[model samples]
Target: MIERELVIVGGGPSGMAAAIAARENGVKDILLLERDQYLGGILNQCVHTGFGLEYFKEVLTGPEYADRFIKKIRGLPDIEISLRSFAVGMTGDKVVTFLKPGRMERVKARAIIMATGCREKTREMVHIAGTRPSGIFSAGFAQKLINIEGLLPGKEVVIVGSGDIGLIMARRFVLEGAKVSGVVEIQGQSRGLVRNIVQCIEDFDIPIYFNHKISRIYGRDRVEALDAVRVDENFNEISGTKFALKCDTILMSVGLIPENELIEMAGVAIDRKTNSPVSEELNKTSVPGIFVCGNSFKVYDIVDSVTRDSLAAGKLAAEYLGRARA
Candidate 1:
């Protein structure tokens, strides 16, 4: 068992920012844990620019944005980083048990911050009627496949959501020499940013079928074709509006859910509306000594907002430790 004044459960944008903020605010003992082998979280896989525009006033890629913070985090003393670590269990009194390398370790902290990020919605979550196929993937998975692994997911792609990831991936597929048949949205309006809609879909001349959905998918072993249908305002498929889109791949980017299983286990009060922890202050959760920030609090449209929110969380966490000591 290890004892620390503060323990951050994630090493993404929020976690890194929180640790830095806490250290600057006089929190001496801090430990940051990440499940990935490195820090930066999902930002590492995001290769696109348009990040840090609001925060840094410069156009940058996701890695570039993360690197800026990581550099600062590395320079801070008394802040330890543990990679390839996962918080598997938590006690009622704020003790966290984690798995790292070949051993299980426990850390008791005066304050804890959860910046666990979010998870992409999958085909199973949407219940898309289709034979189990190989070419189907979440937009995040496809992004990681292309950016990190240097591999294209497929030649022809049909995106099933108009959210940011799906929209961004539509352009990525085109840039990578893959044909994006269309971007389909079940809702009438796009759920993504206006710039993404214009740059990713409209700019590429990729068809966007609003009030439409992929009703069914067809393939034996891999994706061959999919059935697209126009839906009414009520989201019911209209008669005689079904069409076939021939594509080798389907990317699902319907939604993102906050990763808060451990927080829930710790008996934190959750906001029913956001499905995230109920935060009264900038990042203070209902559970005292346990702060929630970033996507774990509520999904932010931009990374700049995440950093701002997490900076406050870190400061508050430091204050919490200070009060405890006083």
Candidate 2:
């Protein structure tokens, strides 16, 4: 196996920031592996302007924010980037196995940083009883379909959960000439930021039903409607509050969970509640020389926070390498 001083298992904002930090801290032979064809990850699909306010002190779109880091990574020759490289396995001793286009490779690194990001909660995860239909999509997947693939998922939409992504999509669907019936949230208030709730829902005059839940989905071949009901403080459905939301599509934007399976494969202790590594300190995992940052460690509210946390992780990895060499 090839030997590396440091290996970062993602190429999004977190991985890029960590790699850059490690290289600047005097660690050489670093490798960054990204499963996607591009390095930006989900940012590539986010065409809206709201990022980089904290880090760059300027408002930028997701792609633009990611480009700033990507350029820095390109300038650093010490950090090698491997696009379309999926890390499949990792060992407790820092052995990482990944797959490329035509070959599989392994690297034994002195230190490893996981920046694997987070995954969206789907319809099944939320326990929305529904037929396996065509029109249901996660809010993030809808963003990709609309912004990346240039495909409209549906014409009439009922968004479940007023999470940031769902709120954003409510406006996006309206902008694309689709009718958004309303945003349904089981909680008493929206789960998204104040700005998102204002700009995406309130400003657009999109109705949001608080204390409401999607109890069931109605469809034959595609989404036709949804059974919406109000819930009490205990989340039990309220009687006489059942209603039908006639729509062709359902977008779920409940929440995000950290992607930590790779670290778990490495014998790292995980907190069952958060599904993240059990770290006593920021970015420091239970296993020595293994670090985690960004959404893989825990979902953050903004990209700027992810960058800051990842820079710290990179510094920690560099410090670990220094001790190993000593």
Candidate 3:
């Protein structure tokens, strides 16, 4: 078992920001663990612009924003980052067990930050009746495929949920020579920001159907088409409003849920509404030495908020360590 003054459970924007903040605030011996092969987290796959406006006073892409902080963290000699490290569980007394490339290791930390981030809800989670086909992709997954892997998800796409990711992907699909049929939302209005709606869907001449949802998907091995139906406020399908849309892909941007299995294992109290750790202090969790911020605390719409929230968490965690030593 390795002992550290601070252990951050993620290496994304929140984890990186927290480690930087804690170090600057006088804490040393910081260790950051990331499950992915890289340290940038989801930002590495987000290629479009519009990030870093609030934090950097300039517009940038997701990777650019994450890089700004990543470079800073790299220069900190006291911060240790472990890539491809999957945190399996945590003890109530603040010991964390993680699996690395060749071996599993445990770390006892004076203070812990849960910045494990969030995961997108898939087709199964939304209960859409459909053949389990190959053309379905979550908005984020599709983005990663195109941006990181240089692969196209489909030639024709129907995006469900008008959230920011869905809107962004609609434009991305169009840019990639794919035909976007339209974006469907079950709500009465679009859930994404007005700018994204205009810049991505509206500006691209893509239609957005409010109060509509995919009723069924038809295909044997891959997606060939799907049925969309208008729904009432109660989310019941309105009779005779179903329409068939020809598309090879269906991307769901329904919602995101915080990855909190480790939080639960540590016996941290979670907020039922947000499905994340309950904040007891400024950025501290119900567990005295445990803190949570960014998407792990709540699903944030933007990366800037993640960084700001993490800075507070890091500072508060440092204060906690100080008090413990005193």
Better of 2 and 3 by lDDT: 2
Please write out the lDDT profile of model 3 over residues 206-248, one tens digit for every residue. Answer: 9889999999999999999999999998999999999999999
Clashes per prediction?
A: 0, 0, 0
Would you list the clashing residue pairs of candidate 1?
A: none
Displacement of residue 205 (Cα, Å) in model 3 is 0.8
Q: Estimate each model's TM-score.
A: 0.96, 0.98, 0.96
Among these predictions, the greatest TM-score belongs to 2
Off by over 4 Å in 1: 323-326
Q: Would you list the C-alpha lDDT of every candidate in the order shown?
A: 0.91, 0.93, 0.90
Scored by lDDT, model 2 comes in at: 0.93
Q: Quote the lDDT for 106 in model 2.
A: 98
Q: What TM-score does candidate 3 reach?
A: 0.96
The model with the greatest lDDT is: 2
